[model samples]
Structure formats: structure tokens, C-alpha cells
Target: MPELTLEATSAIAVAFAAVMTVGFAARQQRWGPGLMVVGILGFLGIISFGIVTRL
Candidate 1:
């Protein structure tokens, strides 16, 4: 496997950080079922495949 460049790693890190930061807003609301399901799913999505998607 090819090693990740600084840019690539930064992209993933920034993406992950952005998602988590935004996810905080998903809390502190009348979420009712009040789950982080969407955030969790998005986080998982990034971790699993979002960063490496093809054009």
C-alpha cells in the first residue's frame, strides 16, 4: 500500500475533526430519541470509506 502524504492525512484529519465538531450541535437539542446515530454513522462513513471515495 502507498503511504499517505501530509496532505492526504491532513484532509482525513480535518474531515474527521469537522464532522465531530459539527456533531456537537446535533446534541443540546430536542433530539428526542436523542441519539448520535447520524453523527455516529457519518463518523463511521468517513472512517470506513468517505475519505477514499473515487470520482
Candidate 2:
């Protein structure tokens, strides 16, 4: 897969949050799953930022 640009990383984070919100509304899932997903995405974003700054 291609590497994600900063914009793509952030956009996906937002999109996942939105999807999770909708899922919550329907009582289809709990907070744990969404939290984990966003957590990992946020971590990646943070790591990328650090790498970019160091470059």
C-alpha cells in the first residue's frame, strides 16, 4: 500500500470517528472498539508528525 500523507491520516481519523458515531447511534457497537481504532490512528499521526519534523 502507498504511504499516507498527513492529510490522509487526519482525514481517515475524522472519518472513522464519524462512522463510530453513527454506529453508536444505532447501538451496533461499544466505545472500546472505536477508541482502539482512533487511538492507533492518532498514534500513527503523531509518529508521522515527529518524523516529518525531524526531516
Candidate 3:
């Protein structure tokens, strides 16, 4: 099993925030649900990464 470093966790959080920001912008612009899907996938990916890193 592996442990996640603080830097890695911070980076992931930053990436998640960026994705959410983009999702919000897209929604405001009426860009359809594609960006929303991407945002959801991004979130899931972050969670998966955390789990994998912890193992």
C-alpha cells in the first residue's frame, strides 16, 4: 500500500476546483451538459486517484 503526500492531495484539490469552475462557466454560457459530465468524471477520477494512492 502507498500513501499520498500532502503535495499530491493539494494538487488534486486544485484540479478539482479548476474543473468545477469550468463547469460553472459552461453552465452559465448554456454550453450543454457535456461540461457537466466532464466535471462529474473529473470528480470521480479524483476520488479514484485518492483511493488508489492510499493503497
The candidate that wins on TM-score is 3
Q: Which candidate would rank higher by TM-score, 1 or 2?
A: 1
**In model 3, how large is the Cα lDDT of residue 31?**
64
Q: lDDT of each structure? A: 0.58, 0.66, 0.72
Q: Candidate 3: lDDT of 45?
A: 77
Clash pairs, candidate 3, are: none
Regions more than 4 Å wrong, model 1: 29-55
Each candidate structure's TM-score, on Cα atoms with residue i matched to residue i, is 0.48, 0.45, 0.53
lDDT of 1 by residue, 9-52 (tens): 56876766665566566656656223445546655765566456
Using lDDT as the yardstick, the better of models 1 and 3 is 3
- Model 3: lDDT to the true structure: 0.72
Task: Estimate, for each residue in 17-50, the C-alpha lDDT of model 2 and write its tens digit.
Answer: 6755665565555665675566567667666866
Span of 10 residues, lowest total lDDT, candidate 2: 20-29
